[model samples]
Target: MPGPLRWLLFAVVLTALPVTAGVLVLGEGEPDTAPPETAAPAYSSTPLGDLDTATVALARAPFCDRIPEEAVAEALDGKVGPTASYDAGQAAELAPGIKDVAHEHGCRIAGPGGTEVRAWVFVPPVTRDRATDLVTEAAGREGCSRATAPAYGDPSVALLCPSGKRTWVSFRGLFGDAWLACSLSAPSRLAEQELLDRTGRWCVAVAQAASVVE
Candidate 1:
């Protein structure tokens, strides 16, 4: 399937899935449970102050490299896989206007047991206001809603968008002139609250790692 079509289909599957008390649909067969070994890492809800002045040089490297492998492993409770680079071409195909305002670069990090996290950095020339507008539009999309906890960065926002049996949880914030976001699809069978808690920690880890990137 084409990239856009595949994503659209995924979104449709997410919206169609039922979210019942204590259980969120994942797929056929019994709902899977999260083992204690894979529990969410401890985190602080405090926002990272340095993001207000941090900067990223995308021309020098992809954003994913800046995130520590150990942090990623602990956040998702899984082994980290090779990082895949997302280029401007893919961004244009998904959202054309993205290229006009800033240079877009992203990384998709795969975790053990099929879980995945994706992070992006929109290089300078993209203002905080524009970033806020983009994040608001995304949060308002069907099956997507705002997440109020575990916030970080200046003018930050978080969202949870259910897709099929899993939920896509993300955190985004504007740091200086750049926009950064981290998103992940939670493992199936975990309770709704557990899922949210895990995603929140994942966002915090990504933000903490991003904050130190010069």
Candidate 2:
């Protein structure tokens, strides 16, 4: 995906793509913690590094077959501080610090707090086209802290916090279409800076995964 026209085409393709049975329906202005049973299943279960023929077709299925670098870049731009680079293979590889960071922050290892969070990726075909959006958790209704978009804003990529506490970051290429909301519980031991660093790096990996050739 490259430019606007291509993006538009990709959007159409996305719209036309079959909505999976596992996808949960999210109303606008919902919180990011909504149950997955209600969200839409946006991507297939293809292996991350191996881009098979079917996987490539899925990646290329966007309406215009455009490179949506602009959309992706914009969403990721303002979210976090500087990030280290990781190719597709590396993106799948978790950083050693992730565990330490999560543990230090009081987040559970695999339980509610510090475990590996499941994620999905939306690869729009063009820059001008709307980038796909999804969240680590489902979207929820607005409350004391923040408000969710009127409808399911994006279904391709999302950022999330599992605790009940409130946190927000501006993702450069991702913020526009991407939505993020975290759980209210504060981390047990990790510093906020460390948590942000870990999450931020993971997001960068997501962006790169969407662009890199598997």
Candidate 3:
């Protein structure tokens, strides 16, 4: 070959070598080893025996009438004041929902020393998925955290939130296609576990009462 042509070929080969080497290096790069995302915690699937087959409906009279005063007193560890009831319209406004899709019958019982309990049952027109979503969202509130407790319904979530001088305990669960929620507020000095236990008892009582509504 002539000198000029041979030199041109040599230069082209050198340039192609680097390009090929770069391709090979990139092809042999390490695989992605990043950890997988964590999954949500698992919960029990046991249904509440009493509510599993009951025909759940809003109580004809005030829901407070179904809940015995003794139950309330035991749950709060003190005597309770008069119970205030919220009808469907008022309950719809007070409870959170989308376009008032949920019709809830709620009641508030005042307890001694700045403590209180509020319970509500979501009647027909409310879907179970929507109720579960609401419960999950409530558990994710800023100061709220999930707590371990006995399963009340098919599945249940309990949460605790401490605000200012008061601590709030909440429990929500699904019974058949219906759902119910309850919240208790007490002085922050109360033990969190104790509050959770009380809240659970109150929740069970409320659920039992609501399940038998006609």
Reference-based lDDT, each prediction: 0.62, 0.31, 0.70
Candidate 3 regions exceeding 4 Å error are 1-62, 91-102
Task: Point to the candidate with the largest lDDT.
Answer: 3
lDDT (C-alpha) at residue 65 in model 2: 19
Candidate 2 weakest ten by summed lDDT: 100-109
Ten-residue region with minimum lDDT total, candidate 1: 93-102
Candidate 2 overall lDDT versus native = 0.31
Q: What would the TM-scores of all predictions be? A: 0.60, 0.27, 0.64
The TM-score measured for candidate 2 stands at: 0.27
lDDT of 2 by residue, 1-214 (tens): 6799899998888876656322444444457895567675543322212322122212221121122333223223332222222222223322223421111011111223322322232232323243332232222313222122212123322223333443332122233332221121224255555444444443343333433354
Taking the tens digit of each residue's C-alpha lDDT, what string does model 3 give over 1-214?
9999999999999999999999999988968789989986642222233344234443433466677666788667798876767766652434322234236777778888878888877665446777677777877788889887766554568888888898988887676666677878888898887787777777767876776433
Q: What lDDT would candidate 1 get against the real structure?
A: 0.62
